[model samples]
Target: MAISFDRAADFYDQTRALPPEVADQVTECILRLSRATPETTFFEPGIGTGRIALPLVERGYAYTGVDISEQMMDKLRQKLVGKPHQLTLINADITTLPLESGVFDVAIAAHILHLVADWRSALAEIQRVLKPQGVLIYFHHPGSGATRNDPIDQQWRTILERYSYQADFVGAVTEDVLGYFQAQNLAIETVSVAELPRIRTAAEALQTYCDRIYSNLWQIPEPIFTPAIEDLKTWVQQTYPDLNERFESSYEVTVTAASRAR
Candidate 1:
């Protein structure tokens, strides 16, 4: 079973919400890449909190979102109140969709494939539900170029490994995902949607790790996580005497649009 975001529903938006301008740009990019119009139907598996679906829904597009977390879907429902949208939310697993075949014009997989234990099955289901030549838009944050060199993130990874914390991702990485598309003979196009500026203090970065905002951190056993976090904190203090000092970076959003050859 894939991990559910029920525990994070309340704070998910606060932590993961994109800036309004960036969100609009993402929606536009999806539209341009998929060549979708109001008549195109959209399907999103693991559409937790509607971060990617809401903008399209607001534009009068027909959309359906599926997820195992009712709490997360409820957050999306709350936002739909007093808003006109042709949207449907289903509580279900992505590996086996309830919808009929060849029904949707576009499908979205954003930061979600990594969570599914049987991601191949999920992708098969997505392909099954899409109309012939329908597009699949994959979205991910590759992090700014600086992320690889960021001492804070590097330390966090080191501490995590020292505690025997392993990532629980059962799906393919970016390269594997593209390989899957190639195996299926789907035409693929990649684009950089936007690069937004971000700034945060070292203390704030530490707090985010402590809060386990990232999904990969959710699986760490309490005992292991506690010690690992303490190690991270000590490293942060030793590396930077002033925890309040802020660092600037950028957040890059990339999209890979794959379509079955017509």
Candidate 2:
């Protein structure tokens, strides 16, 4: 079974929010890459809280989202109050979609593949539901090479390593994902979307870890987790003597699009 974001629903948007302009840019990027129009039907697996789906749904495109978490989908529903939109929400797993074959024009997978235990099955399911020539747009943050320079993020990773805590991602790795596309002979088109500036104090970063807002941190055993967090706190205090001093960083959003052959 894939991990579910049911517990993270309350704070998911607060921690993962993109600036309004950046959100618009992402929606526009998907629309342009998928060659979408008003009549295009969009399907998103693991569509927690509709962070990506809302913009398109609000624009009158037909959208269907599936997730294992009812709580996360509820948050999306809360946002849809009184809004005129063509939207359908299903509580289901992505690996075995309950949808009919060849029903959608575009499918979106955003930061979801690595969390699923059977990502290959999920990929096949996405292709099965798409109309011939329909597009799948995969969205993710830039790879480790891009984030290794961020001290706060680096320190947190170090603490986890010191505790010998390995992340529990059961799905396909980056190379495997690209390889799957290649094996299927699906030509991929890649794009880097507009970067969003991020500013946060070292103390704030530590607090976020303490709150366990990230899914990767959720499964850490309590015995290891407590000490790991303490180690991170000590590092932050030493690295930023002034805990309130803000550090600047930017988030890079990347999109890879591939279409099923007719």
Candidate 3:
């Protein structure tokens, strides 16, 4: 169950204040990951709210972004209008985009591949769209290195399924994703040596969970989302016993890069 970034648009930035230095790390890591050349025509699929895309664009990379949410795209549109960037944006699904093939130097599906349903087709399409020797950078949010059967993770899933209005938990594993790219015959490039930051304090974690409920708990009607949210809060309180303490979050992220064989 993939969730779209909608009602979350307004508070998106507020909630996502990654440490300033993290940008440098992401940029450097991506550059190292993809070996992007000056001539690289970068593609950032799922460019939500221009968080990474904007900074990458500022670095003088030619870019194209694709996204499914109109509200998110609208915000990005506003960012691109006033800035000087060598970038283009399209409102389409990455899984089935309307675009030409062999046109770009690199295609980056940043933090988005997991949310797509037909991920294999999307990857194949990405490979098709890139010229031979071009690279594909796939980024994902893993469950912070927690094993698939981690008790905490299982508990979270159970709570969400039974209590959350919509159960939208998608996990992207680094090794498996890398294997998929390899099966396509794309030359393996790099896999980050370090894991990505996944969790935050208990309060932050709780707030994030609650926020998603506001944004993605759509299985229930409007009248029910709130009640369900309250129930979740009560459950969390009873479970944690210390609602103010920062609980660890399990949101690991991974980045893999591969190049089309010549």
List RMSD in Å for every model shown: 2.1, 1.7, 4.0
* Tens-digit per-residue lDDT, 98-117, candidate 1: 99999999999998887777
After superposition, candidate 1 runs with Cα above 4 Å error: 141-149
Q: lDDT for model 1, on a 0 to 1 scale?
A: 0.86
Superposed Cα deviation of residue 116, candidate 3 (Å)? 1.6
**Model 3 agreement with the true structure over 1-262: per-residue lDDT tens digits:** 4457776678776766455666667677777766777877887777888777777788889988888777887887787786788878887877777889888877777666656667777777787788887878776545332433333345545655665344442434455577787676667755543433554444555665555633333344656556655765666767778766554443334566788565
Residue 153 CA error for candidate 1 (Å)? 1.6
Query: What digit string (tens of lDDT, one per residue) describes model 2 on residues 1-262?
Result: 6799999999999988889999999999999999887789999999999999999998999999999999999999999999888999999999999999999999999989878878999999999999988999987634333443578877777778777776545676566678889899997898989787888888787888999988777778999999888888888888889999998877678888988554
Is 1 or 3 the stronger prediction by lDDT?
Answer: 1
lDDT order of candidates, top first:
2, 1, 3
Q: Model 2 off-target regions past 4 Å?
A: 141-148
**Lowest-scoring 10 consecutive residues by lDDT in candidate 1?**
140-149
Error of 1 at 186 (Å): 0.8
Q: Highest TM-score, which number?
A: 2
